[model samples]
Target: MSSAQWNAGQAHGEAQAKTEEWVKSAQNTANKACDKMADSRESAQHGKEQSAGFIQQGAIDGVKNTLGINEKK
Candidate 1:
């Protein structure tokens, strides 16, 4: 092949390699973002469960106090 043809082929190969690398980098970033979102959702769900438990316990204590079961000796 001529030198000019060889140089053109090399340039095309380099461009393709760069494009593939960029795609992989973007995919990795998207995966990390998705993982973070899932983690945040799980944390929020756990917080909700804990808050509900606290509210339930407080209600029980309030009822007992109203019935004079919590009176001081």
Candidate 2:
């Protein structure tokens, strides 16, 4: 076999290995981004639930005050 042919084969193999490594790195980055987004969504949902509870309690309290129950208690 000629040296030129062997060199070309070696170069092609190296290029293929580099491409695989880049693909793996990109996949890891994408997975981490997805995980962060899920965590943020869950946290926001929990916060919304807490806010809604507080608003509902305030409305109940307002009704009790209007009915004079709050003063009686």
CA RMSD of each candidate after superposition: 1.8, 1.7
Q: Output candidate 1 Cα RMSD.
A: 1.8
TM-score of 1: 0.86
Task: Go through the candidates in order and give each one's C-alpha lDDT.
Answer: 0.96, 0.96
- Looking at candidate 2, what is the lDDT of residue 42? 100
> What lDDT is obtained when candidate 1 is compared to the true structure?
0.96
Write down the TM-score of every candidate.
0.86, 0.90
Tens-place lDDT per residue, model 2, 1-73, is 8999999999999999999999999999999999999999999999999999999988988999998787545
Model 2, residue 60: C-alpha shift (Å): 0.7
**Winner by TM-score:** 2
In terms of lDDT, model 2 sits at 0.96
